[model samples]
Target: MPTGVLYVMSTVVPGLVKIGKTTTGRFDDRMRILERNGYNNVTGLHREFAIEVERYDEKERMLDDIFSKARVPGSELFALDINLAIELLASFEGRQIYPKTSTESKSKVFDDAAKNHQENTDIQCIPEGTYYLDRKRPPLHVEMVVEDGALTIRAGQRVAEHDSDRADDRARELRRATVAADGTVRANVHFSAPSQAAAFIFHLSSSAPNLMALQKVVA
Candidate 1:
């Protein structure tokens, strides 16, 4: 029955996180060593979340098993969502060690980060309008709009039809779209930066128009 700290570290690569455990007394020393020399030659390793708990070894093993599919072979790295990892780690019963906040919960960390991100990057910088895919015959359309003081993107496939068909097909498309509380169809995704949005849209459609262009097209 050893008391130790379970820590999650973020690597230079996005979506890659490391989970490990160290004795309470050696926690600070271990972190310093990892940060200074790097782990397995993986530099830029920084602690994201950590907690002191009883039987930290077992907790670490449990987390490894839970995220086994996402784990990198022969490494502690896991290609997992950072926020989800933080939320799951916070759910465990322990004293939050990293972040060194007045409150033990990590929700405040996320809230503050989001607030700072929104403040520093003006979402309104991008004009509110419809942007079509960068193709002769675009298959999808992305509409930018301001709702509740936040910029939102509503994207869906482009369907061509007559007026009667539009009434029926458009309604169906809206029904499938993610609806806000105000009955507005929102894509249900938020981008901290235009580059992030461009990456996401690129994943959806390789030929899709990027946010950098800021070209408003009527389709």
Candidate 2:
């Protein structure tokens, strides 16, 4: 008689979920690698520790099928066999962890200001390519090649998504590019309507130096 087990896990980070099954009880050894790598929030929320899994020759494949259906975008299994492969997949996706509270607090104001400024002007990192607007939407994504001194613009599904939608959807009247005085390849984006151009201009002027420091860390 073959025996097997099933488990459902939720990691320390949000948006991670997984389902897996194993034939043996030694899944912990496989899971330890995750803990070693700082995934301290991993928890097994549900499991069927032992079941007659060997009755079917396709048990491994069956587990894989279950995992494919139940596993979330950022999750994987931990046991050997089907479970190990699943866990490997989750590790590859990379879980998203929250920053510390103090770090969160520090960036909140900058995020707010960015949102406010983005509402009025679309300050974007325009790459070194000519682009035209399509009736569907404006291009919001760019591919940067610093070595080549080129920035290629392309259509994106969302632009300034962190900001609220405006009543008038039209081309932005004011856009400013923030390049470093050191001439490094870096850019910051801000956008506004014609009515808000003056405020956007003033904000960029006052914050350019600080923004440079902020960009340094992000870059």
Candidate 3:
């Protein structure tokens, strides 16, 4: 049987490192997904090394030795730049190299009053009208367009005239979204009380560029 060490770690562009491990090889998929989603230039390496111990404790000791003898990020032992082999080994530590399955990586956001929507009242609902939106991905702020019956989402200079179903899905997640008959989008979007709603709003604001413009409309 063939056996080898599996590592799961992440590196900072320019320079930084996060190390990890796993028993399986799924880490590769995770790294790919991250790259496709936005994180690029990541690399994974695997290699075989000799073991001097047969017992479990002995093997543990050997791993510890390798760690101690290497210049891993947080390791206090060994000279900072002297361990080439250890640096290579440190690459796989604590990082997942693979992307998770769709089911596993799907967006976890949804309607849940249980999550504290006090601040939900703060999400300003743009009036029913017309506006532009910049399309990209989740966490990217959208442009606001107030109109009647339906709302238009835009990406870049182009409006996302299509994907109404998906757009509606996005709208519904907003507790303060409403659409009116006169083509007016309205919402109070209160941002106070429990920390979760505030956190969620902050997250959306920071991650999504122009989300305040993508205010959900309601009727």
Candidate 4:
């Protein structure tokens, strides 16, 4: 069974919530992605809570059924208001969050990231595409193509993430990306949100999902 993280979120609006899942290490990345797109007319999304489950897909469906009365017109989003929505989640929670494996000190995390970067300087996962993000002057972005669940994050693009555990965890995956004439990053990562993809390329924090705005150049 694929063990992963299940996230339940709500927006500032009264009656809407989101339930989604992702890999354990990629939860923050996933949330940043959803929080970016979770709101309809609100500032952003607020996570109600999240937990790691052995059968995440099954749990999601189970929650969907339990809250069938609050089912909304769209996907995964429920119509239950925030207060009751969160309460229902707590009541119907099937499993608890995954336990931490090891908690590294902030300094150690940075040190380990630097070492991993130096050690993984040769691997590159490059693809072909003229992808662009932002229409501003000197828009910060990458041009890459996807193949076999892997892709290359181009050079010339830089992303600065926070000095928190979230960034430290993401850095491990970021280090393996090899920079080439075209790619400064190459790795076996997949992002559901375009924003998430952009953040991954830029090495930003899990909030990358909220910050990226990449678009295809359409050559």
Q: What Cα-based lDDT does every candidate model obtain? A: 0.55, 0.30, 0.28, 0.47
Q: Per-residue lDDT tens digits of candidate 2, residues 85-172?
A: 2222221111211122344432333334344434432323222223221112332232222113322222221223222123122212
Count of backbone collisions in candidate 2: 16
Q: Model 1: how far is 156 from its true place, Å?
A: 37
Worst 10 residues of 3 by lDDT: 105-114
Per-prediction TM-score to the true structure, in the order listed: 0.49, 0.23, 0.19, 0.38
Number of backbone collisions per candidate: 0, 16, 52, 5
Error of 4 at 67 (Å): 1.5
lDDT, model 1, position 202: 31
Tens digits of per-residue lDDT for model 1 on 1-219?
788898888888876778888988898999999888887768888988887888777767766765666788898888766554554455455777888867544545433433343445444433344443232343434444433445445544322221222133333333344443333444555544333333343332211222222234434
Kindly indicate the candidate among 3 and 4 with the higher TM-score: 4
lDDT of 3 by residue, 83-180 (tens): 12222232222221222323221111112211222223312222334332222453233334433433333222221222233233333344224333
lDDT of 4 at 18: 75
User: lDDT, candidate 3, residue 104?
Assistant: 23
- Give the residue spans of candidate 2 off by over 4 A: 23-25, 38-52, 55-60, 63-219
lDDT of 4 by residue, 95-170 (tens): 4342222443322322333333234321121223444444233345455554444444444454333233444355
TM-score of 2: 0.23
Count of clashing pairs, candidate 1: 0
